[model samples]
Target chain A: MSDKSSSRSSGFDRRAFMAGAGIALVPLTARAAVQDPTQAAAQDPALPVEVTLRVNGQDKRLRIDARTTVLDALREHMGLTGSKKGCDHGQCGACTVLIGDRRVVSCLTLALAAEGQEITTIEGLATGDRLHPMQQAFIDNDAFQCGYCTPGQIMSAVACVKEGHAGSDEDIREYMSGNICRCAAYPNIVAAVKQAAPDIMKG
Target chain B: MRSFLYQRATDPGMAVQALSAAAAANNPLTQAAAQPLAGGTTLIDLMKLDVMRPAAIVDINPLARGWSGIETGGEKLRLGALAKMSDVAAHADIQRHYPVIANSLRLAASAQLRNMATLGGNVMQRTRCSYFRDTSYDNCNKRIPGSGCAAMDGVNRMHAVLGTSDQCIATYPGDFAQALIALDATVEITGKSGTRSMPFAQLHKAPGNTPDIETTLQPGELISAFSIPRRWPRSVYLKARDRQSYEFALSSAAIALDVQDGMIRDARVALGGVATVPWRAREAESLLKGQKFDDGLARRAADAAFADAKGRQHNSFKISLGKRLVARALQQASTMEV
Candidate 1:
């Protein structure tokens, strides 16, 4: 609360301490704002990150643009095209994916942030040989037609089951409101989510 | 869609420094316009729509620690800016302690977006002006400075009429802001120049000729948190939107009231999706400051809020709707047991 406390002025000089401790600068914030640098050796753009995604249980390495979105990374790069890009924005949940078992809109998630993270695309819904319970219920309950929004709906449904949100039809609708079914498959989708409630819980 | 460089700052100081340097390096129009990427729930979407075109994205996610979490240690409760809307709503501490703030964010936008967008970004997003978003048009001072505002003469059912000029009339959108203002919260901000803390009232300003200058934040300043003092009170967030969920409010009210034996001790209130800023109904609050929490008092307070309301042709219905929202929110808040 004093002028001394007001201006330590060292809040952003972590590299100064690192050098005094006989450690190399982390280059984290050092080159972050580097402008108009001509030294090719010193101005190497921060290393392009290589991330290995364990989507479901499959392992894959991605040569990703530093700014590549998770939705684009999955759809365009990895070819897990099941997740639709209806909005390519976060408004529509057509690109929902599970990051570390939590459902999120893949389009809004940055791929670089997914480093060392467990991800589950819509393709990872089924148990290899058997269609996942949610997937089967959608078929049984007739939850689609021109099924453009099915993949995202199924992904969110799987999440609802895992997160214990499938208590009732209304709860399913509330939890899955993020997924907009342009085909207006609301009644059937609600029934499908309800039917999968028990099997999803049994697991 | 020209992409320049990207850097994620690990902390507040680093983020401020990076943003300051970038802002200093370029004018408004440059190859290095720096934008701090908060949830990007709206920013990324706007960019895809070609509404905004920032060259550099300064990732503030690393700075999320500085802006998130709730601390209820002192006379005032603190809320971090990065706390997810869903997390804030579900947090037992926030719900039991300050349900108004929590509920406002919870009922805002959609569930998935609530998880992605930060409270800061939610507060700072531009109005949903169709002309602003349309790159094909040459209008919107907020979107393209000095291009002229098409919203002034166009379909402006959602535009702000209380604070308007020939320059612009876009509505100030966001639901969470209404709750903060109603609670008389203090916004804690950090920038390269220094740190400043002030009432949430100071953070927002009315649009005069400069409709593009939306907020009071400096070039490199970042909102770290908000603080609200604890007092014996009941509060509620009332939003009337196109739908019950996943819709922006046409008009919303956040009301906080403290009463004893039916007599009011204090009333702090604000409104959203109505004015140029989160409209604080100080006049209305004064109406109930020393009055009882009865139907008459509620009606008087609500009436006082809109006594000075000026509405555009399309949104004149909001005059009655906004007043009703105030009365309803107050009645709902009063119903909560002390």
Candidate 2:
């Protein structure tokens, strides 16, 4: 009877040991499972940024909380949607705009640092219905497919061609490498840039 | 996407004062705070991703005092901190004389960025570590106060091997800064106290245990000028990237030489994209000094640059790349009839 009782107690202890082990690991498993990607993304501590961006031709005070990109401000706050947002990052040229007169990745620029400067978005590229010369050449060459990356590609193309970077095919290729047309319309884009060089040069 | 506050200062002093106040306010009991606003090309992007959320931004571009002019006189060229990348690159004086500075700016991010960005802003921009950039999870001491550096061992293809410590390994990402360092440039800065001038080589510090402190820019200080002494015989800036333009360098070289009588009287060379700071290649400079500019001399100098390049597993490619950059930079400089 004593021996049987001891064996039964040992069995109870084994069950208790297993239960304790399982309980200890539950938090670790939960920790991994509960890690939210968005939450994880905001791990960096927050700092406030206040900037005044001179855009298109206006000086406006911007005190942005949660960090506002020049691209977001141009499209979201200012309601200028001509500059498309493809990759929110700096990889794609979909969000290209001019800070002073040169092309830059607006998506990468902080709206706070844009004070006292002229910003020219795609909407600013035309006079009423007349497009910039490069924009017209792009239309003539059908240099876009879905038109998602057109504004940025056009802006970059204008900058490249106008800057006399089209001195040679290699030079043009080197300069235009910044803009990527995922639609695979590179040949037409290059041709349109070449076509618009003279008018762009004069301008 | 979240809520925050913004403030703009009328000038640089106000900006610095605001920054000092906010930075000091780092919730001594909670977390760190405040950052100065420049061109916002790098920091703002991270903020949108919700990576950074400082309580306030001190507007610094208002410092008209920060932006000045290019003065060519007294054996050195002085570039005002406010000189736009485009302006500096397009300057007849800079291009005709210091081609390295012009070339570095020409190969920077993009034309639009050149117009928006100041020379001072480019030098002060943060590291380009993927982990530091990601709005999501990754180990980067620079981004997080002390989150433990995940990049020290993992996916460190772009991490620095030289001038790096166990606490941090992110590579410095400025093209023009290296050229400035090679040409023996000095950054001129002014603060609430006064003004200071230091060699560009000493501007950046190695990522010791304290990865948070990148430079010695004093509180309420603003860079006013970048000065380069004249008398360089030949100079070039060569950068190798995944593509041609508008991308950060994978590896790059900057070299300025004063050669005479089939021998180098003075030589200065610097390397970027491989170290924690603008790395001036002194051994290589020494090797090429008093020697003819030739393939043999170039190789010998190239060897000197890699002698101390201790790379991590993923970035061992930098060693070979650094060698190539040195050779290419030397070759390009040699061809220039200065």
Q: What TM-score against the true fold does each predicted structure earn? A: 0.87, 0.83
Return the DockQ of model 1: 0.16
Give candidate 1's root-mean-square deviation (CA, Å).
9.4
Cα lDDT tens digits, model 2, A94-117, are 888876657888876656555557
DockQ of each: 0.16, 0.14
Q: Model 1 misses residue B324 by how many Å?
A: 1.5
Docking quality of model 2: it rates as incorrect
Residue A13, model 1: Cα distance from true site in angstroms: 41
The lDDT for every candidate, in the order shown, is 0.74, 0.73
Off by over 4 Å in 1: A1-54, A57-59, A161-164, B24-32, B231-233
Model 1 clash number: 2
Summarize candidate 1's per-residue lDDT along A1-203 as a digit string, tens digits. Answer: 01111111232243355557786433322224323222212322232345566777777787544456788788877888998878666777888888877778988777755655788887887777899998999999999998888998998888877766779877777778888888899999999999988988888
